[model samples]
Target: MTNSTRCGECILPDSLPGVNLDKDGTCNYCRDFARKEDRNPHLSADERLRRLERLVAPYRKRGREYDCLVPVSGGKDSMLVLYAACRLLHLRVLAYNFDNGFQSARARENIQAAVKTLGVDLITYKPNEKLLDQLFKLFLTRTGEFCTPCNLIIQAAAYRIASQNGIPLILSGGSSRVFGGIQGVSQSKYADRAYFKNVLQGHVDFREAKRFVVENPWKRAVRRYTRTGPNLVDVLDYVYPGLEQTRDLLEKELGWRPTSDELEHGDCVLNPLKDYLQNRKWGYSEVTQSYSSLVRTKQMTREEALDHAEEEETRQPPAVLESFLNRIGMSREEFEQTKHRHFTEFPNYPQSRWYRMGKKAVALMRKVV
Candidate 1:
């Protein structure tokens, strides 16, 4: 099949689901950001700092220990958040890392350096490696992707740790404005335990399925109902220096070293395989999404973003791919069969009446908030 069309202004290709191009050859995302920019003024760094201070002042020294839990992957974004919390906002912070056994050596070093230099406490949580391997194999064979468990565990562990420690806030480095609008599939439909179990019902034993899927409904309820339940906030929404400025700050202030790979994907060794599969399935990868964001923000010219995206799109690390397959006990034939399988064929969360009601309740809560 031939490739889909691309945005005239950015590297966002027309292959993305639900994306539309206007008569001017710009995609909806670029047009939306442009419209918002015309309607509202961008917040200055000083204004961001003032707003952050006001939001954080009441929480300062409220608990006996740290004021917030900052999840770090030693990526530039997380490093900036850690620096802002300790140096800029002057809040006592606890840095948390969830090691999924795929972290690169440089990422580990960066995490260690950030915590040591900032003088914040560090906590690393490692999941059961055997169970993780089984889940990865199952997902790769059944669902065509294997990051669902990793993402779910990271979020749940962060919230659970915060609740257990009496910390009321969990500061994450994720930002919708900087890292949004790129997903090909609906994550909420498949990125939860309910969907996971739906897929694994017959493939694996019930006990193994119970161990692999890590969603605790009681914990979720406690987090929602209790006053001390951790509140997750994105640091970037308040204090977003452009990407270039943030990189410069990391190098100058924190002695961070840049990697040849994209920093946003972190140090996962399995990312190349995932990106390759994404390219095969949707004709684009996370690099396209990230560089498109940079182009829209005017941090990088479209030409530069296109160059970077092209390089990422074509390159495949054979050794990493082979190692990942071996670790997950997936043979080459299985890998090929899984890669060719259509993404929609995979089992996902059913859109039942209860699910629809839950979505409406969430929307109402958002409006009230």
Candidate 2:
């Protein structure tokens, strides 16, 4: 969209390829949030902490001490959960991470430092790289979506670990919009396990999910075959902070610093892959739309998140992009042609080569336009 008519408060406008503005001088998304919030008051930090404490307390009984399982990536949000549980609430935490095949060394180092600094027990689960790479390409090129499967695998493993260890609660750093807004009813996208289960079911087969995780040799040998025989932990039994509140506490109180390469999605290296696939699958970056929506909704300041979005835009290196495309066996010609096709259709789904790819790609690509 044209800069002139872009929302006075945010970096979105009608000129945004497929964006629509509302009478309130905000985008339709911003207006939607405003309406949602108008209906309810947002939760406060104390309330959020109380909710979290209540969730964690039952598991922290005298004989049983572990409070929760936190899925961390050494990013701002996960660290937010880490520090809040240990430093703020004084609860025992199990810091869990999934070493997806594509993580940056810096991210790995950050994870180590976070574990050491927080003095929390760290548990890592890594899968077979060869199979993961194949799956990544198949999902990205054929399905045009890798995150749904990747996140499901990680979450499944993390909860299984927690359940095996008898940790009754699973805490998540998903409270960004729930407490960030000043008005009633904060804006956010995270929900409970049922929601996530539905999300996973929509994309992948539950029976096949076990196969995907077992395909990882390390996990199969160390985790699956071990005594911990596939445990399922309850997810709703925990509290979490909203994005802004969590960031503030983590950086200010616990000395957690965000890595230089983090995007609006935080320090996950898988983000570049997500951005690439989304941008390729659709004409616009999902981060652009998601962050811009956060700005428009006033959950985050337009200037702050927009700058983060722009900064993230520049962080995608040419070499990494080239490597990812090459790894996926996608030719530059095919990639460019996809972009051209999407732009030409502009706001319409381009299904010209529909028969060539699989059903997943057709379905995921259709969601974008």
Candidate 3:
């Protein structure tokens, strides 16, 4: 709670809860063996297991029912979360993934393995690649960040499925604290439709985003699928599981094994770019942003987070940058210049927030090159 209390190892501020400052101004969260205890008391792993059991008991009684709908990417967290829902809680889980066109073959393989081995029903919604490419271009060139629609598309694909099936809960990994720190607890449950709508309203209309999509490949596909239906897409407040509980299920039930690469950091392919962007623009990586709050909350240590941060810069391959640049029809020089031009030339407004976000994202891309 004291601003003077800094983590002994990492750069986390003292404002974070559970941060124990030593004589060196370093907090306990920066040291080895980070403990979880803070202003809010979360259930322990064993207790979490019991709570999960109680939560899923009603659905388990319904027979062969998916007690929770999980949005997965076949990453470590996804694998871990899916395993927890099925084996730990003894509830059937419907594994959901919205393929945004950047998945690696290994990720796909892992996803298939989790679904097959766990005996959970799997549902996938893929945005057309052509549409995805176009959207990415617009996001990259026009908006600069993925912005609301891209986030919506991913959430919408899963929620549409949840709504149609009357699934009451959609389970996800982690919390908002994973991003903007404890003080910025703005993100509610990703499954809450009302919350999603309120956040979306802060941006632009779903119709505008859809207009961009319809003008692209997804529109063509949607036309083929028949458009007559109520809007099933929404955010809901399904359960949010913790890291410790997530790990136990992954280790015990799913027989999940981490690849050598995943032992340090993220299990997703998108992270390299995500890290690069955050670092270049925000002077931080997602891990820094993520674990900053975790340290305050006592869910993780500063040393553990810094260990992950060490891997961030090395993960981006030279070929990936070349490919990204080529795919966007811009060389590294052009990309850098274009980014600079946008920041200097673009008119500023509340509507232009996406442009600013994109600038931040682009700054990362420029730094990596």
Candidate 4:
């Protein structure tokens, strides 16, 4: 298993959990997508732009101080979303960020540069230091991974701020075709707020983590059923130009640069730690998964993906993983014992009703969308 058997059509490797290659060497994921490919009719660039305009116009007419909320992590994707919210759509934009205390300094610099250059108001939210460390330790013990809470809570915080301020939209720069799951299927990674609630209910007090979390399952259901909340839109599905074209645009627009190697997971300081742990637990690399996604979409050739996969696999685990353990009061030995554990390994993981419902809701949304 030193090297993974990859799909012929895409870079997806058989090492990914649940990935299977047929005799023809095409992975199940590629086959599944082929069956559903026609579900999404290819929209012309012009028509996509037109759809975007109509979608945001009603939100813009609500007479809010800011027409939309864009979460900026100082990554090119989020920065581009901020750029589009301001320069492309000519909307008054507000930017939101949450620092879990592990974000890279380069990312911080990019955020400042983007907000200053774009002339948008910004909010930086930080969770309570003591409780955050506790959650980190808890997650590592339960799940081999620890990035889920950050993903969920950031969106939760965004929704909270949007609800309080009457902001009508949240535009995230996410694309399903980019850096998708290793199995080539996009599934939530125990990262929804409902899962956050499932993790925290008996362990951490609601009042203690009040500033950083919100867990109202009934309200969430109502909002979903009524469809009466700030419409969160992924700008990539609508306005994406291309990879190089976006990079070039951000460089010219906000003096942005890739913070990491080949624009993989440069946004977070702990990304290398993530790669190391997940590779050990799941027998795959995030870099390979992303490159495979590029190959899957025909954005990059298989030869190119293979070359980068080899290069990416040679990367050593970063020094930050050890320091991160120290910060969370975990010794190297404790980490070694715990790092391979998956969330599902715990007794009654994801036991909450809403979290189960939320997972189904994600699948349903994908079908109609």
Number of the top TM-score candidate: 1
lDDT of 4 by residue, 107-135 (tens): 99999988899898999988777877888
lDDT for position 48 in model 1: 82
**Candidate 4 deviant stretches above 4 angstroms:** 1-3, 182-188, 210-218, 225-228, 346-369
Which runs in model 1 stand beyond 4 Å of their true positions?
38-41, 185-190, 204-222, 225-228, 262-266, 314-317, 342-350, 361-369
For 180-230, candidate 2 gives per-residue lDDT tens digits of 221101101222233223334445454543633323323433554364433
TM-score of every prediction relative to native: 0.89, 0.67, 0.62, 0.88
The alpha-carbon RMSD values of the candidates against the true structure, listed in the order shown, are 2.8, 10.2, 11.5, 3.5
Per-residue lDDT, model 1, residue 332, is: 84
TM-score, predicted candidate 3 vs. hidden true structure: 0.62
- Model 4 lDDT on a 0 to 1 scale: 0.76
Order the candidates by lDDT, highest first — what do you get? 4, 1, 2, 3
Give the CA lDDT, 0 to 100, for residue 41 in model 3: 68
Each candidate structure's count of clashing pairs:
0, 11, 12, 0
Q: Is candidate 2 or candidate 4 better by lDDT?
A: 4
lDDT of each: 0.76, 0.55, 0.51, 0.76
Least accurate 10 contiguous residues by lDDT in model 3: 182-191
lDDT of 1 by residue, 239-321 (tens): 87887788888888777766446535646767677777777767677768778888888878899888888877734534687
> What lDDT tens digits, residue by residue, belong to model 3 across residues 1-369?
122444555555455333457787765544433443344466565665666566656544365355568888765665765766676566667888877655666667777878888887888887656655544454445433333334557566665676577665666654443343322111111212332233334444545445222123233335435743212211111333445554555656655555324232344455465455434443444455455555554556767766665554433333455666556465576444333221212232223566457657756867998
- Whole-model alpha-carbon lDDT for candidate 3: 0.51
